[model samples]
Target: MAALTKDSMFERHIEDVEKDIVSVTSGETRPAAGIDSEVANFFASQSQGPIEIDEATDRRLRWMIHKRVLLVMVVTYFAQTLDKGTINFASIMGIVEDTHLVGQQYSWLTTCVYLAILAWEFPTNRLIQRLPIGKYLSFNIAAWGAVLACTAACKNFTGLIIVRTLLGIFECVCQPAFVFLSTMWYRREEQALVIGAFYSMNGFQQCVGGLIAYGVAQIEGQVLKNWQILFTMLGCITFVWGIFVGFWLPDSPIRATCFSPEDRLLMAERVRKNETGIQNKEFKWYQVREALSDPVVWSVTLISFTNGMPTGGLGAFSNLIIKAFGFTTLQTYLLAIAQGAIIMTFLFSAAYLSKRYNQKLLLAIIYTLPNIIGTVVFLTVPTRSDTKVGLLISFYLTMAFGAVSVLNLAVMSNNVAGRTKQVVASSLVFIAWAVGNAVGPQVFRANDAPRYIKAFIAHMVVYALQVVVLFFLRLYLMRLNVLKRRAAALRESTANGEDRDEHLAHNHAFDDLTDRENPDFRYTY
Candidate 1:
């Protein structure tokens, strides 16, 4: 009789806990009580026999994921960057004379791509949410590859703008896809390193791009200008590469064909601890509101804007600046290889240290400090041959901002939750990026030419301002974490001896809840 009574009490307690966790009222799920049926079903399905992922299995999975996914990401980013950066190389290869570009028309060439991005980002983001990401990205890549090929044939400013606009529309898919896909496959701890490795492709692309352009520059007496030959060759290569992305890349873990059904389940279960759901098709208006209202999103967007000014200025005119320092055209291209190396070193190091030390936000601030020093030197140093070496060193150090950029992207990815909200936040950040890049080139007029003292001063001010913003963003996230922890504590205290399930308390990691709605969703700094 005593044993029966105790068993009845235990069963009753379990039922009460489940009731608290799985509650729904009037077709709407309350954040505090339980997750939606979709999330609850996913957890029940994946939790077959204790979700134990062994170390060896984890290593194997990571290796496969990198081989399958990371390879595509790096190659796609490299091609996109190489194609976009060709304009800088082309400037030295005689595009200025060939196209009859006058005054700010050359600057407008760079601005057109970003302007297109700004115009299309939100609509593209909506498409990303609704469509199969892998297929969508692959199609866009192939489409852009064709546009890039067409760029080789552009004869005038209008022709260039038309193609560059198409390039921007197609290329906008890359970053957001990578961000969402990283969240899909990896844990929060692993995301930074993976994102860093992929984003670092920009640096590698710079190196290879310089080499390719240098090779093209050696050609003479051909029907086409060397710049045209360079574009045509790179565009053809990218077009072929796009086919590979379409066929090989998997969209999400659940949809991945490389793994078995059992392995796929494990893959989905693996990221359940991320407290951000894998994929949610429904676009909730409240989540969109939450994202726009969040201070972190706006702060990150502002940071992107400020940082992008220098990025755009340097990217568009770095070769011109270096040539102004008295290096020959070929010499400028070769020296750019060195700049790429510096970028690669800093970006990889920052990501590694952040992963090793768990200081994502701190490393972002630290990386920007070098850019401040670099800009100050550039502003003060006379544009004379005697001081060229100092200016070159400053230029090299300024590439440290590359690290800051990678960290910022990782920070945004790490903090935001909910598929719709993440998409919205990413769109806004990239929109800011577009605006910054567009504004950056306008600062460097034909009149400013070689030294561009005004441009460097702008960079210096923005770098310093960026540091301040990062500090405040960190403080804001920490405050949110503290508040959430307190709420969690209070909720636990009132449990009345009901057993608290770890997964239940986590509110189902795949539950389509905004970060604000899920009390268990703590902000990662």
Candidate 2:
């Protein structure tokens, strides 16, 4: 049957059950009217299961969404990555010496950014949920762009930290908004690769930013320093792009003015197979309680933390490590291009393997093992002129840490199913991310600078923790899937074999129910 026509039989059936109490995982039902009205309107509004769309239609529709939705996500992520990595680029461009930074002050610059993110993540998530997420991100993009531009004016540690903190507050919205947008615009099967497409921009920016830094560093006889020019140029570009996104990117299927009314309904219908609701405005606190208590959620959260520490240390120190191995300033910038390539390769590979083989947790461990081995080799290799080549190779291998983030989001986005719960759980994971980042730089103390052997040692241990946590997480999800299967079988026998799937259908699909409350929901590893 066609979806969304009011005159149809499905629309009529929807009217009858619009307010009907529905069964939950606990076998209890309550008056629930908390889903997005766009989704709640007309037929197939709440009651129908997946609409069997043809493969051709699916391909065309996905292409349209990629153009309209995923493109915006990609550029926004790319712009943010450039602005965030500018400080690392600037480390060689004279920001530290010009600003009179000494000892641990440089490390604190990196730490303070994540600390600000850790402090503001929850409130930022709340605003993201309550607002038009696309527009909200646009505003933040412009705000952070302006803040990054102001980094050119900082004359001391205090000034740089203040601006960095503001930049963190604004940019913290990027990841959460994109995670929720993956749910809004794509099917469950498509989310992993779609997320990777945007996320790989970090590596893309690494290449692009390195070349830009190299060109800017060659400027001579200029009043504005090379670092100053770098920040101001990227910052202005980001600010302008934010303005463009505000005008261009559509909010959601319900509010997408770019598509025809018929297309909007079709878009909404397309995502219903997720068995997860499209949009929800109401804040349900009990769902927050559930996310906090769930061990599976915590397992993902821990993996994020473990993965974050190594990334922080490496991101902040890797360029310096490269410079320390007898390379010139220009060579360091040039070498970072290879680092970006390594990052892009790992991210693309992880995304592809997970989507093709349906093995996220296993792939996460695979991605991490190289990072562990790389850190070991990095510490063991002599930091001499002769071993610089070996040292660079080891450092590049450590870039695989960037790939783990794809798996974290793939597992988190596919598993969690409620607005507030998603908000809280993702926030917790990033909070762990922030704490680990904050701590990651501290291990690379100035006393240990040059090789920073302690930092490499710390990362080896952190990578091991990540592998252990991810193994248990995989086991936990497997156990849940088994229990769900057994429960379905038991319920089937009790129903006298009356096509038990008929009873287990997604009756609460649009109720804004948490995954735990939706009996039809299954875990995705």
Candidate 3:
């Protein structure tokens, strides 16, 4: 080449090096946008070797954090379940006998709590974002514990109603706050297992609460009834736990002191990598709008609403259903313990499947299928002595969906990207849950006892509907994933092309500059 220019020589050298690099790198390929090379160069200049740390030491640190966080969440949720379930326990202890409430009025007690939860959910969730989560959550836990204790002092339907309303308001903060706290600590892949551990307590509480009630029911000298003693004991335990939370719970990875500086940095980077970005410094209105406009949000909400109706009915009246089997109070309490154990087993299995397969919607539908079958058996099976065991077992079997509820929460959190949108979506989902709870209890009128035919039929219908909703929701999610992949491919192709004018038009049409501005942004699946 006559008098080779420096540019021509450099170009020839680059081409030769590229061929050598491609040969040695095997199948490795670069991103069309040049982002992969850019990131590789940045990391290459930062260090001469890979980072090192003691694996065993890191393991111990993670274990400590996991234990502390799990304990706090389990105790908090246990207190909530105890407060809500005390009414069911109390019903068996003759509170209904003393209060003289009739017909649908008893159902109103359950309804009122849910209504209050619905009214306060969104505002309380937003408050969690604005405040220090650990402190705010602890205060709420303490307040609700005090309210639970006060339930022991109620003398009539009105007193019970007032106490339940207040309890609902305070307890509204627990679930959302706990979810937010857990998210701050873990990546999405690890989230389901931790969430499952905490959520398993919903089943465990039935066992623990039943045992406590059995012991309290034996108390003969108290001025108040034994059921009142049950409430007071649970409340005191919860209050103490709240005090412990204030000292033990850390705000976030950035602020936590339980780990070394390196561990903290690792935790932060791990989360950032999974989320495709660091924690947002400020909320964005556009992100909120995008989340609200998502079709999956509504689909997820409807599935929860339908699934919750049967869940609420069962949770609120499982004791009454057990009592219908003609067992003594002590026997009923023992059976409740067994039921709780079975539910726990089922919950754990479902949680494992959810984590291992990343198949939440499918797992939810599978869980609902059993309940639908149980409801049908309970409704249609003859009430003869021979069929009694089937009915009782079916009643206990329906509670297996406890894991599905946990999965639903995890799904919603993972699927909503922005902080504020996650909060809003959570609030909306729980509001649907509250509304379902409000409607569920009304199906089990006092007159429908022994068979509760109407309640059984209602549950069947609702559960079947839930299965349908989950099927369609899964399809919707699959289609959305396909569309997102296609869009990403098209963007990559445009970025790699040579047509400046066409690329500019395409970029303007697709708002491609937004992606460049925030390169780390990712759509939640």
Model 1 alpha-carbon drift over 4 Å, by segment: 1-50, 490-507
Best candidate, lDDT-wise? 2
Q: Which order, best to worst by TM-score?
A: 2, 1, 3
lDDT of 3 by residue, 1-525 (tens): 555786597457445433433332342322221222322343344443333335685566567667767678877787788778888888888788777777777788888898999999988988886666778788888888888899888878899899889888988887887777666666676677777877777778789878888888888987888777788888887788787788888766656777666665555444442332223333456545545665566767776687678777778788878877777779889888888888788778877887788678788888877787777778778776677778888887788678778777777766555465666677888889888888888888788886789988887777778778777667655544333333334332332221223221111111111121222222232
Candidate 3 residue pairs that clash: none
Worst 10 residues of 1 by lDDT: 491-500
lDDT of 1 by residue, 28-80 (tens): 35543234454456557754543768999888888888888888888888888
Which is better, 2 or 3, measured by TM-score? 2
TM-score of each: 0.90, 0.91, 0.82
Candidate 2 global CA lDDT score: 0.82
Best by TM-score: 2
Looking at candidate 2, what is the lDDT of residue 160? 97
Candidate 3, which segments miss by more than 4 Å at Cα?
A: 1-58, 276-283, 490-525
- Please give me the total number of clashing residue pairs in predicted model 3: 0
lDDT of each: 0.81, 0.82, 0.69
Q: Per-residue lDDT for 313 in model 2?
A: 75
Rank order (by lDDT, best first):
2, 1, 3
